[model samples]
Target chain A: MRILGIDPGLTRCGVGVVDAEGRAVRLVAVDVLRSAADEPLEQRLHRIASGVEAAIVEHRPDAVALERVFAQHNVRSVMGVAQISGLVLRAAAANGIAVELHTPSEVKAAVTGYGQADKRQVGAMVQRILALESVPKPADAADALAIAICHAWSARSAAPTAALTPAQRAWQAAERASRR
Target chain B: MRILGIDPGLTRCGVGVVDAEGRAVRLVAVDVLRSAADEPLEQRLHRIASGVEAAIVEHRPDAVALERVFAQHNVRSVMGVAQISGLVLRAAAANGIAVELHTPSEVKAAVTGYGQADKRQVGAMVQRILALESVPKPADAADALAIAICHAWSARSAAPTAALTPAQRAWQAAERASRR
Candidate 1:
C-alpha cells in the first residue's frame, strides 16, 4: 500500500510519501512546500495547492492522509491551515484518491506510542521508525512522515494483510491481541 | 464595471453580480449554490468553486467581492467559511480578476446605514437599494448583493472618480470636502 501524508500550512506545507509492505513501512519521499508571507493570499494558496497537486501526481498514492484540525489557539494560523487543508483534500479528490484525516494526537500515538508526546519525541520517533540517519527538518516534514507512518501502521494493525506470509500474519494477530 | 459578490459558505454559497455605472449599481444576477453536509468536503468545495467560476465566466466581472471572515463563535463554521473564501479568491486570481473583501458590518452599513442592523433590516435595504419588488429569497442572496454594493460604494465614496464627468467630479469633490 502507498500513502501520501500532508501537514497542511500556508507558509510551509509538509508532504511525505510512504510504501507499506504488510507491517513494514518505508518512507519514499518527503519535502516542504513554502510560500512567502508577503505574497498575496490568493497566490500563496495557489502555490500551496499547486505544490500539493504536483506531489500527488508524482507519487500517485492510494490514499492521502492529512492532519485533522481541531480547536486552535491562534485564529489567524488556524484559518490558513484549514484553507490549505481544504485545497489538498480537493486536489486528492480530483485525482480520484481516497482521503483520510488523523489528528495530531493520533499520529503521535501511532508513531511514539504516546498521544501526548512532545515535538522532539515525535521527531525522534519518526526518524527511528523510518530508520533515517537524521530527523526530518522544520518539524513539518517530520510531522508529515509521522502522519504517513500512522496511516501505514493503522492499516496494518486494523486488518489482516493478505500480502503477509502465514507466519507473519499469525505474529501480527498475536501482537494485536497482546496490545489489546 | 462589473462586480461579482460571493457569500462564502460550505453548504450554501451565494453569488451576485452587478454592473456599476458611476454611482448607480444594477444587479445583473444572483443565485445560491448548495452542497449537502453529508457530501465529502472536497466535493462541497469543488461545487462552490465551480459555481463561482461559472458565474465569472458568464458575467465576466471586473472584480470579485467576498465577505471577510472575522472572529466567530462557531469554530467549525468559521473554518468552512474561510476555506470557501480561499477557493473563491483563488478562482478570481486565476481568471485575472481583482478581489476585495468586505466585512459583515461594512456590508450591513453600506446597505442599511446601520452597522449593527439585523438581518431583516439588511434584507429590506437590499431590496430597496436594488429597486426590487421583493426581497431576494434566502438571506444569502441578499447578503451577496449587499457585499457587492458595499464594494462599489466604498470605492466610489473613498476615492476620486477620474471617470466621472466634470460636473459629477466637482460634486464628488464637494461631497468629500463636506464629509471632512
Candidate 2:
C-alpha cells in the first residue's frame, strides 16, 4: 500500500509519500509548498491546494494520512486552522480517498515509542526507521514522513488479513475497466 | 488609499478591497477563492498566491490588512494557520506593500462597536458601514472586508500631518517608478 502523509500549514506545507509492504516502508517523495510573502491568503491557499493535488496525483497513494487538529486557546487562530483542515479533508474526500487522522501523540508513539516525543527525537526516529542518510530538513518534511510511517505501522498492525471488501472490489474492477 | 483585507483558509479564502479617504471607506471588491477537494496542497497554495498577486496588480492597494495568529491549544492546527499567514505576509511583502495585523476581537470591535459581537452582528455592521444591498456572503468575505474597514478607520484616526521625509519620499518615488 502507498500512503501519503501531510503536514499542512499556511506558509509552508510538507508532504511525503511512502510505499508500504509487510514490515518495509520506502519513501517515494518528500517536498514542501512555500508561499511568497506578498501573496494574498486566497491565492496562497490555491497554490497550496494545487501542490497537494499534484502530489496526490503523482503518488496515487492507497490511503492519505494527516495530523488532526487539537483545541487552541485562541478562537480566531483555531478557527483559521480548522479552515485549513477543512480544505485538506475536502481535498481527500473529493478524490474518494480514505483519510486517516492521527494525533501528534499517536504519531509520536508509533514512530518513537513515546507519545510526547520532541521534534528532534521524532526526527531521529524517522531517520532510523527510514534509514535515511540524514534527518529531513525544515522539520515539517520530517513530520510528514513520520506521519506516513505511523500510518503504515498502524495499518499493518491492525489489519493482518484485511483485504478489499466486496463493494471495494467491485469499485476497483469498475475503476480498472474505466481506465482501460 | 485602497486597502485589501484577506481571510485566509485552506479550502476557501475570502478577500475584500476598499477605498479609504479620511473618514469615508468604500467597498471595491469582495471575492472568495474555492479549491477542489481532490487538489494538492502545494497546487492550492500556488493558485491562491497567483490569484492574490493578480488582485494586487489590479487594485494597486495602498496597504494590506490581515488577521493575526493568536495562541492556540492545538499546536498542530496553530502551525498550519501560521503557515497560511506566512504565505499571506510573503505575498504582501513581495509587492512592497506594508501590512497591518489585527486580532479577531479588534476586528469585531471596529466593525460592530462590540468586542464580543456575534457573526450576525458583525455582518450587519459591515452592511451598515458599506451601505450595501446585503451582507457579504460566506461570512469570510465579510470578515475580510471588516478587517479592511478597521484599518481604514485606524489610519484615518491616526492620519499624519507632515509630508513624507526625504528618505520616505525617495522610497515612494522608487516604488511608483518600479510599478510604471
Candidate 3:
C-alpha cells in the first residue's frame, strides 16, 4: 500500500509518499509546498489545493494521511492549518482516495514509541525506519514522512469511512478488491 | 453592487445574495446549504465547497461578504466555520470575485445600528431594509442577509482588499484589464 502524508499549512505544507508492504515501509517522495506569506488567503488555499492534487495524481497513493489540526494557541495559524487540511481532504476525496487524519501525539507515539517524543527523536526514528541516510527536512517534510508511517502502521485500527461517504469507501473497497 | 454573504458552517451554511444601489438594498436570494451531521468530514467540506461555488456561479455577485469567525468559546465549531470560510473564500477568489470579511458585531452595527443588537433585532432590520413582509426563516438565512447588508453599507470603509495582499491586487488588476 502507498500512503501520501500531508502536514498541512498555508505558508509551508509538507507532503511525503511511502510504500508499505506488510511491516516494511519504504519512502517514495517528500517535498514541501510553499506559498508566500504575503499572498492572499484565497490564493494560498488555491495553490495548496492544486499542489496537493498534483501530488496525489503523481504518486497515486491509495490513501492520504493528514495531520489533524487541533486548537493551537495562535488561532490564526491553526485556522490556516485547518483550512488547508480541509482543502487537501476535499481534493483527495474528489480523486477517490481515502483520507485518514492522525493527531500529533498519535503520530509521535506510532513513530517513536512515545507519545511525547520531540521533533529530533521523531526525525531520527523516521530516518531509521525508512532506512534513509538523513532525516527529511526542513522538519515539516520529516513530519509528513512520520505521518505516512503512522498511517501505514495504524491503518487497521483507524475509523474507516461509512456507507454515505462514497469516495473514501470506494478507495477502501478498491484496496480490498486488489488485495483479494 | 450585489453581495454574496455566507454564514459558514459544516452542518448548515446560510447564503444570501443582495443587490445594493446606494443605501437601497434588495434581497436577491437566500438559502441554506445543509450537510448531514454524520457525513465524513472530507465529504462535508467537499459538498460545502461545491455549494458555495455553485452559489457564486449562479448569483454572479460583485463581491462576497463572509463572516470572520473569531476565537469562539467552542473550538470544534469555530474550527469548522474557519474551514468552510476558507473553502468559500478560495472559491470566490477562483472566480475573480472580491471578498471582504465582517465580524458579527460589525454586521450587527452596520445593519441594526447597534453592535450588540440581538439576533431578533438584526432579523427585523433585514426585513425592514429588504422590504420583506417577514424575517428570513431559520435565522441563519437572516444572519446571512444581514451580512450582505453590512457589506453593502460598509464597503467604502472596510479594508477593501487594496494594499493588503498581492494576489487580491493581482486579481483586481486582471479584472480591470478584462473590463477594459
Candidate 4:
C-alpha cells in the first residue's frame, strides 16, 4: 500500500509518502510546506492547498493519513490545525482518495511502541524504521512519516507475511547494536 | 457594493447575498446548505465548498463576508466552524474575490446598534432593514444577511451620500410603524 501522511498546520504542514507491504515499509518522499504568518489568511490557505494537491496528483497514494485534531492548550493553534486538516481532507476527497485520521498518540504508539513517546523518540524510530541516514528534520516531517507508518501497519496487520522482513530485521538489529 | 455573507457550519451553512449603497440594503438571495452529519468529513466539506463556490460564481459579489471564528464553549462546534471557514476562504481566494471576516458581535451591532443584542432582536432588525415581510428562517440565514449588511455599511461609511437613502428611510419608518 502507498500512503501519504499529513501533519496539518497553518504556518507549516508536513507531508510524507511511504510504500509498504506486509511488515515492510519504504520511504518515497517527505517534506514540509510552509506559509508566512503575516500573509492574508486566504492566501496562506490557498498556498497550502495547492502544495498538498500537487503532492496528491504526483504521488497518487492509495490513501491519505491525517492527524485527528483534539482540544489543546493553545486555542489558536488548535483552530489552525483544524483549518488545515479540513483543507487536506477536501483535497483528498476531490481526488477520489480515502483519508484515515490517526491521533497523535496513535501515531506515536505505532512507531515507537509508546503512546506518550517524546518527539525525539518518535523521530529516532522513524529514521530506523525507514532506514534513513538521519531522522527527518523539523518534528513535523517525522510526525508525518510516523502517521503514514501507523496507517500502513494497521492496514497490513493481517497479511500472510506478518514476520519482520529482512530490511525490518536489519533495522531492528542496528537499533540493538547501537544500544550496546 | 455586493457582498456574499457566509455563516459557516458543518451541518448547516447559511449563505446570503446583498446589494447595498449608502444605508440602503437589498437582499439578493439567502439560503442554507445542509449536509448530513453522518457523511464523511471530506464529503461534507466538498459539498459545502461546492455550494459556496456556486454562490460566488452566480452573484459575482465584490466581496465575501465571513463570520470570524473564536473560542467557543463547545470545542467540537468551534472546530467545525473553523474548518468550514477555511474552506470558504479558500474558495473566495480561488476566484480572486476578497473576503472580510466579522465577529458575531460586529454583525449584531451593525444591524441592531447593540453588540449584546439577542438573536431575535438582530433578526427583527435584519427583516426591517431589508424590508422583508418576515425574518429569514433559521438563525443561520439571518446571521448571514446580518454579516453582509455589516460589511456593506462599513465599506460605504465614507461615501458622500452617507445620509439615509429613500429606501432606507422607508424601512426606518416601517420599523417605527410596526412598533406602534
**CA lDDT scores, all candidates in order:** 0.84, 0.75, 0.86, 0.87
**Candidate 3 lDDT over residue span B1-180, tens digit each:** 678999999999999999876577888999999989899988998898899999998988888999998865599888788889988888877788878899999999998889999999999989999999999988889999999889888855234643347786678657755852
Q: Taking the tens digit of each residue's C-alpha lDDT, what string does model 2 give over B1-180? A: 679898776567788999876557899999987666577654565566567778888998888888876654446545545545656665676577777788889999988888899989988988989999999998988988999988887744225312457687568657756863
Cα RMSD of all models vs. native, in order, equals: 7.7, 7.3, 6.0, 9.7
If you assessed candidate 1 against the hidden native complex, which CAPRI class would it receive? Answer: acceptable
**Once model 1 is optimally superposed onto the true structure by TM-score, how far is the C-alpha of residue A152 displaced, in angstroms?**
1.8
lDDT per residue for candidate 3 within A37-124, as digits (tens), equals 9988888888887888899889888889999888756877988998898888888877777899999999999999999999999999
* Each candidate's clash count: 0, 56, 0, 0
For model 4, which pairs clash?
A: none
Best by TM-score: 3
Residue A137 of model 2 has an lDDT of 85
User: Model 1 misses residue B157 by how many Å?
Assistant: 9.3
Better of 3 and 4 by lDDT: 4
Each model's iRMS: 1.5, 8.4, 1.3, 1.1
Compared with the true structure, what per-residue lDDT tens digits does model 1 show for residues A1-180?
678999999999999998876557898999999999999898898888888899988987877899997646687788888888888877877777778889999999999999999989999998988899999998999999899889887853324465678898778657644542
Report the number of the highest-lDDT candidate: 4
| Residue-level lDDT for B154 in candidate 1 | 83
Better of 1 and 3 by TM-score: 3
Better of 1 and 2 by lDDT: 1
